[model samples]
Structure formats: structure tokens, C-alpha cells
Target: MNSGDLPPSRPLLVVDDDRKLCGLIRDYLAPRGWQVDMRHTGPEGLEAASTGDYEAVLLDVMMPGMDGFEVLRELRKTSTIPVLMLTAMGEEADRIVGLELGADDYLPKTFSSRELLARLRAVTRRSVRSGEAADAGKEWSAGDLTLNEETHLVTLDGGNLELTALEFAILASLLKAKGRVKSREALLEEVSDRRFDVFDRSIDVHVSQLRRKLGDDPKQPRFIHTIRGVGYKLKEPA
Candidate 1:
């Protein structure tokens, strides 16, 4: 199929060791205008993702052999295909790890399929956006920080920050709204290209990762500043 014919209503791969769940997802998603492919093993899932022409990948964190993190890391070495992870372990640490490893989103195992579908749409929408340009202000610069909305690229202090799209978006949003304390929900809504909800800790993880990449110390940040109990602001250098 043509590239234009593939996304928004294209095939999505579901990788889980639980065959029954995979079957259920395939059935549930098929009617919603998605072509679903199911796999019960990590290696197979990775292989399928690497070779097949799927628009997005839904990966389960705990598989018998390779595991989702391993597969995601391996896939990152080459492909930039969007990946959303499923985890039975709902620990914040696990979700942070997945995000750090380049996974787009993480869904806890008990999450509803309806929620999964919403997340899937959101993730795919983000992937599609990486190929396009943000409106009007497609480029933003402050001090030594620069962001290209068209290319989804960010550079800080004369060095290129190898940020994920979300990370770049988060930074861009902060820079765009410089001097304003943007709440976690506001940042999530701005950067994630979707609605903000209760589980907004993902924005925090992305910000933390961005801080590390930019060498901004939480205790003595030179760029992003945290408000006591509110949110974050971009510190424009003098």
C-alpha cells in the first residue's frame, strides 16, 4: 500500500505472549478500521516489526525470552517505528525505563482495550506528526536552545540533544511558553498531541530525561526550573 494509504487506518502489530489477549485485540481493533497482527513471542514480534509493513507496534513488557524492553532497544538501533509498550508492572520506574529506552507510551496490563485504542490512536498520530511541520512557528530558539518543529529536532548549548519526539515536543512546548509555569497536564496536552488526563507522570519522565540530556541539574538547573508544587518553566538565559 502507498504510504498515504497506510496510517490512521492501517495495520497495527500487537505483540504479547498471551495468545488470548492478542486474539481479543485483533478482533476488537479490526472493526475499528485497523488491520491487526498478533504474535505470542518477543523475538517473533521483533522480527515481524522489523520486516513487516505495520504502521505501529504494540509490545508487551514481559515475554518468556526477549522481553519488550530488549525488543524495543534492539528496534531502536535501526527503526524509528512508533512503539507503545504494555506492562504488568505498573511501577513508575518501569514506565520511565520504557520511555528512556525510546518507547512512546506504556499501558498497564489491566488497562481497558478502549483505553488501548485511544492510546494507539494517539501514538500513531504522534508518529505521523513527526513527518510534518508545526504551524506558523516551525522553529523556536532561546539562548542556546533551538528547536525545529518541522524536523522534530532540538539542540542545546551548541550540542545536538538526541531527543525522542516527545522529548523534543516537551522542550519545544516549554520554550514556546517560556517564562510560564506549565502544569504537567498542560505540557502533556501540548506535547503529546492529545488530551491530558490523570496519569501525567509521563511528562515528568520526559522532562527529567530532557534535563539529563541538557545537563540541567534539578538542584541547580540552568534551563528547566521546577515550581514547588505546580509545574515547570523554561529559564531563558540572559
Candidate 2:
């Protein structure tokens, strides 16, 4: 069929061993203009993700060889393509690990199709928005840390820090509000354009990753601080 006869397709890669679930997702997303490709093995998924022209990847945490975390680690070595992780329900550790490893977001395996669609849209949208903002040439600095929005480059102590897209977004959000506390809810909405869930700890995970990259000690933070019972803030250099 011609492009006009159907909605514009957004290509997505789904890396999952559950053939049944993959089929269900394909059936549900095909009509909605998502061209979903499924890979049943982690190595296969990693290969496809590296070579494919996909807007995002839907990765399952459980797989035989290499697993999703390994696949993600390998993939991030080369690509900044958005990734959404699928973890078992209530598996907080899995979710946190996935986020720390640079997955854009995570959903429980028991998620509804509607939630799946929403999460996918959120990750992709965040990716696009970040790209646009990065092209704007805006720059922000706090302490010895500097972030260049246009180039998506961050430097600490005159050295470059390799940050994932989500990490950049979270750090940029904090730098923009330097000296002002930004609640996790505010950061989540600002970075992902999604409603905040009080129970969700993905934002915290990302923040911790950012802290490590910034060489900020959580107990004696120099760049970012955790305001107990509140959220986080970029410390204004004294």
C-alpha cells in the first residue's frame, strides 16, 4: 500500500523471547503505525539494534545468552538509540539496573497494551525533544560543571563526561534550576513529559548515574544534592 493509504510508520525493535507476547505487540502496534521487528535472542537483538534504523528499542530483561542488560551495555557502547526496558512486575532491582545502564525507561512485563504504547511514546518523544533542544545552542553551567545543549556535551573540571541521552536531559534539567530544588516529580515530567508516579524510582536511578559521572559523592555532594524528603538540586558553587 502507498504511504497515504496508511499512517506514517515509526520503526521499533522488540527484543523478547516470548513469541506470543511479541506477536500480540505486533498485532496491536501495527495498525497504529509502528513497524515492530522482534528478535528472540539477546545476541540477535543486540545485532539488530546496532544495525537497524529504529526510533526505539523495546528490550525484555529476561533472555538466554547475553540477557537484556548485557545487550544494552554492548549497544550503548556504539549507539544512543532510545531503549525501553521490560521487567518483571515488582522487580525494582531489575528496573533500577536497566535505568543505570542507560535504558530510557522501563515497564513491567504485565503492563497493559495501552501503558506499553504510552511508555513507548514517552521515550521516543523525549529523544526527539532532546535532539531539538541540543540543536538550540543553549549552554548552562554550575560550579565546575558545564553543559552545552547544542552539542549535548558535558564537561567537569575541563574533562568531558560521556552521558546518555536521558542522563543529559536530567542533568540539563537540574542545571537549568541550579540553586533551586527540583522535586523528582518535576524532573520526571520535565525530562520525559510523563506524569510522575510516586512509587517510580527510575528518576533516582538516573540521578545516581549522573552523580557517579560527575564524581559527586552522595554523602558529600559537590554538584548535585539530595534534599532529604524532597528531591535534588544542582549546588550553586559557594
Candidate 3:
């Protein structure tokens, strides 16, 4: 295909200590709309990813000098780049840890080419959605909770709350449709372009974490209410 006919290449960073694996990834993604960059150490990855140049990062869990979790935790402090964590096959704990540390998505280390592309696209899509929402409005509020979409800040009862990117998106989505039902399918579509798998509970998990940050109870909730089989709705401002 001619260069003009190819989709625009997105800058992508792959952070892994395995030199051979990094090279393999670069070869695989370079022509598939991703201009892949490789980083072999955790510190190097952290520095490169913090530069705000790449559209996404594929971070491996195991690395020398520093681990992926540590890098993700530190990166989240300053940047909101989409991060897809690569964990050892079946390491559910690692996946959970990565998500808690602000990773946008997870993939198994033995991932197929298709799976990797899908995940990379999904995380980037999520990031884009969040950025669009940020520019859509300055601030959204309900009761004592407030989210500054422009500033990417969340506060409850005047106290600042630390929230992950996913948490922020979930909350912002809820507030944007305040007092209206946001079905799980609709919310998932907004977050990523991935195909729907009803069994996926990541959205629920994120919402629960957001509620904990707001000190909201699932029963008689103060900010978010579960719409049973539908999805969730943010309580309207009092």
C-alpha cells in the first residue's frame, strides 16, 4: 500500500527488558498504524514515556532496576498517557495491580498480534474519549462531588480525591449524563472501541473504586446509584 493510503501512524512506546521482544514488537506494529519505540529498562521507559510524545505505552510487568508497577505509579503523577500493561500469562494479581496503579488496560505477555493491536487501540481510544470529555465542559457537579473536566480534578465535599484515569472517565461520564441512566454497554462503548463481552466487569470495578473515593455506599448511595440491570446514574445536584 502507498504511504498516502495507509492510516496515520501513532507513536507507541514498548517498555520491556527483553531486547528481542522489543524488536519483534517494533517490527510488528510499525506498519500497522503504530510507530513503535522500544525501551529496555524501567527507568528508561519512565523517562521516555514522561516526555508526552507517545500516544500510548505497552509496559511489561517484569523489568530491571524498576518494575512496571513502580513506573506506572510514578508516571501517573504527571502524565495521563494511555498505558497497556503486559503481564505474565495468568497473573491475575499483576493485572489487578497494574490497573490499581493507573494502567488503562492489560494484556498477557504471550499475546497474539491481533490481541496486542486490539488492546493498544482500545487504551488509546479510551484516552481520546477522556480528553474529548475534558474539552466538552469545564466542570460537572452533583451534590458535594465535583469534577473539573478541564483540569482533570475530582473533589468531594471540597476535599480533593485521587482517582485513576478510568475512575475519572467513569465519574465524568456519569456526571455528563446526570440523573439519566447510563447503560453498561453505552459506557463501555464510550471508554473503548473493543467488542462487548458482557462478562467483563472492569467497568464495575472502576465505579466501585470511584465510589469508595467519594465515600459513597452502594446501598443508599450518595453520589452514584446502581440502576440494577441497566447500569448507573449520577445523583443530581441538590
Candidate 4:
């Protein structure tokens, strides 16, 4: 497809040292409505990401010179773009490290092509939609939290809280539907475009991390409250 015909809104970057693997992933994911870009090193990936054009980054964990973790740290220093790390099988520690370093998700090596496509779509959808100006300047308030949809920023108790892309989306979704309980399935759909699976615990993990970042106690959440078997709700601060 020509540049004009490309889905600019769905552009994604795949960063891996493996030239063959990168080519394979880029080829496999291109026809699925994503404009895929490939990078062969962490520095190159970081430079591309710094441009702030790509919707999301699919980063590989192992690379020479600058590893994925180091790259992740550097990217987090300046950007909040959604990042999904590609780890090797049984590398649970690497996966956990990537998550704690602020990656939005993880996909171990030997992952299914279909699953990768699903995740790429889900992540790109979330990123492309987050900064979208929907109902501009509409105010959404929950508890001590307030969001200006136009500005796309949040304040907790009158203080600015640094939030990543997924964190902001999760909170925005919860605030947009304050009061009613939103099941995990619904929340997953809200964050991504896909339906929920019993094995998919990533949303829960994200919610938990968001709550922690927001300094809300799960036992008595001041902003987001869990609904046990159902999902969660954004508690309007009194």
C-alpha cells in the first residue's frame, strides 16, 4: 500500500536484534491493518520511538549493546507509549522485570502468530484511542480524581499524577462509567478491542498496578474499587 493509503493511525514498531525474526513479524502483521516498522537494535528502536509517531512498540528482550530493559528504562524517561516486550520461553524473571520497568505487556518467544496479532491489535487500539479527542473538554470526575478529556490529563487530589498509556486508559474507562460495576471482561474490552479469556489476567495486573500508582488501597479504594467476581468501579471521591 502507498503511504497515503497506509493506516497511519495503526502504525506499530517491532524492535528486535534478530533480523530474520523482525522481518517475519513485520511481514506477518502488516496485512492485519497495521503499518509495521522494523528496527534491528535497541538504540535504533529508541530513536524511532522518540519520534512519537508509532502507536505502540513490540520490543524484544535480548539485544546487544542496549538490552530491552535498558531501552525500556530510557523510553520511560521521556515517553509513555504502549510497549509490549518479547521474552524467551521460561524467562519469567525477565517478563516480571519488563513489567516492573513499565512495559504494558509481555509475549514470550514461541508465541502464536494469531495471539501476537491479537495483542498488536489490542495494544494499537488502546494507544490510538487514548489521545483521541472525543467529546472534547468534557469533564469527568471520580472522587478526588478529575480528568479533562480535551487535555487528556488527570489530577488526584489536586496533584498531577504521572500515568502511562494503559494506566490512563484504565482510569479513564472506570471514571467514564462511575457507579456501575464493570466486569473484567468489559474492562478488557474497554482497554483493548478483544474479548476476555479466563487465562487472561493481564487486565487485573494492570488495574492493580494502576491502583498502586494512584496510591489507592484495594481494601478501601478511594478511586477504583474492585467488585469481587465481577470487575471494578471508580468511586467518586467525597
Clashing pairs in 1: none
**Best of the candidates, lDDT:** 2
lDDT of 1 by residue, 112-181 (tens): 9778877877777776676678563478887888888777777877777676656666787788888989
lDDT of 2 by residue, 59-166 (tens): 999998779999999998889899999999899999989998989998899999888888787788777766675558799998788998877778988999888778
Better of 1 and 3 by lDDT: 3
Ranking by TM-score: 2, 1, 4, 3
Tens digits of per-residue lDDT, candidate 4, 52-162, equal 588889999999999999999999888888899999998877877887788887899999988887776667666656677777778888767787767777887799877
- The positional error of residue 206 in candidate 3, measured at the CA in angstroms, is 1.8
lDDT of 3 by residue, 8-121 (tens): 678999999999999989888877777888888899999999984999899999987899999999998988788899999888788777876677788888899878877776
The per-model lDDT (C-alpha) reads: 0.80, 0.88, 0.81, 0.81
Residue 214 of model 2: what lDDT?
Answer: 86
Clashes of each: 0, 0, 0, 2
What's the TM-score of every candidate structure?
0.84, 0.91, 0.79, 0.82
* Full ranking by lDDT: 2, 4, 3, 1
Q: How much is 167 displaced in model 3, in angstroms?
A: 3.1
**Which is superior by lDDT, 1 or 4?**
4
